[model samples]
Target: MPRRQHITVFAILALFAFIGTSFVLMFRSQPQGADYPGPTSQEPVLVDNEILLGTATAPKLENETLKAELGNAAWKVLHTTMAKFPDKPTEEDSQALKSYIHLFARLYPCGECARHFQQILAKFPPQVATRSTAAAWACHVHNEVNKSLKKDLFDCSKIGDFYDCGCADDGPVKGKEKEKEKDGFKQLELEKEG
Candidate 1:
């Protein structure tokens, strides 16, 4: 009787252990944390709705050479605008431009160009002063890149009488005989009146 009771107690413990192990395994199999799914399981950071319009991916301003090129381009654009409307940019425009430059630096990291620009900005300092001008410039560069890419991707139609309706109708008589016939009747009326 004693042996049977000992066996029964051991069996019950074993069953409980099995059940506990199964529960743990089941829990482990399920994903934890926020229920929201992200871009990839490997990507630690997920940016939602941060996609730039007209682009599947951001412009890759990776190397120092590229950075210098972008900087030159941006500077040229800003300078031209400033020249065109001397007082129009104001403090805000300067700040915005500086911000754009900094952004380009971060993306491209042209050491020489960045150093030169930094010194110039420090001495002259654009109208609007920000706490971290360099950092702001970095962000601005990104904005500029995005803006440029968007502009290149999407070309708006000019508002004018001239328009391409995407139809291939050369010399006005390939597909509308009825319309042509109506015009002919108007010409006949004018002739009869004359």
Candidate 2:
């Protein structure tokens, strides 16, 4: 076999080894036996009539670098999601967004950070009535986290400018469509008169 072929084979083997190890570590890390279910008997915590996962403790993520990277990525995902939410959401849509925030806090990788977020959720309780309110709520909660971490607070009013999400602007579409429909009707009336 050529040297390049040998190198390719070695790389393939290394990749497979890495993937296998990752699977093993992931499964091994799961909580064993009875503790896996987490909080069976106690009543679930609730805020705004939404059920919350109880404050079960998790081992703190001690690696500061990894924690910071995770925090940045998570915040981007969260802010963008809120930014794209429907302008006038249904009750179910509102509830789903509220539930997702609670779940995200409950399952956040940094255990100590997750607990802090849970406390924030309990106090703030996700304002999901509309896109503007939901996005504002997310900004406010992010500011709360920033405050707790002694970081510079973000100006909530300028949140949309910061998290653009690069999606097309949907804010004015409904009003524009209504105007077009009214003009279309007027054109039809003129045609019938002729």
lDDT string, candidate 1, 1-194, tens digits: 69999999999999999999999999997788847664586766532223211112224445867776766676555433322322234565555554554443333344444444444444444332322232223334334444644633211111011122222333453547645533432332101100
* TM-score for candidate 1: 0.24
lDDT of 2 by residue, 122-165 (tens): 77788887666777788888989999989999767666556663
Provide the overall lDDT of each model, using Cα atoms, as 2-decimal numbers: 0.42, 0.76
Give, for candidate 2, the lowest lDDT window spanning 10 residues. Answer: 185-194
Q: Point to the candidate with the largest lDDT.
A: 2
Best by TM-score: 2
Angstrom error at residue 21, model 2: 37
Candidate 2 matches the true fold with a TM-score of: 0.60
lDDT of 1 at 117: 45
Please give the lDDT score for candidate 2.
0.76
After best superposition, candidate 2 residue 193: deviation in angstroms?
50
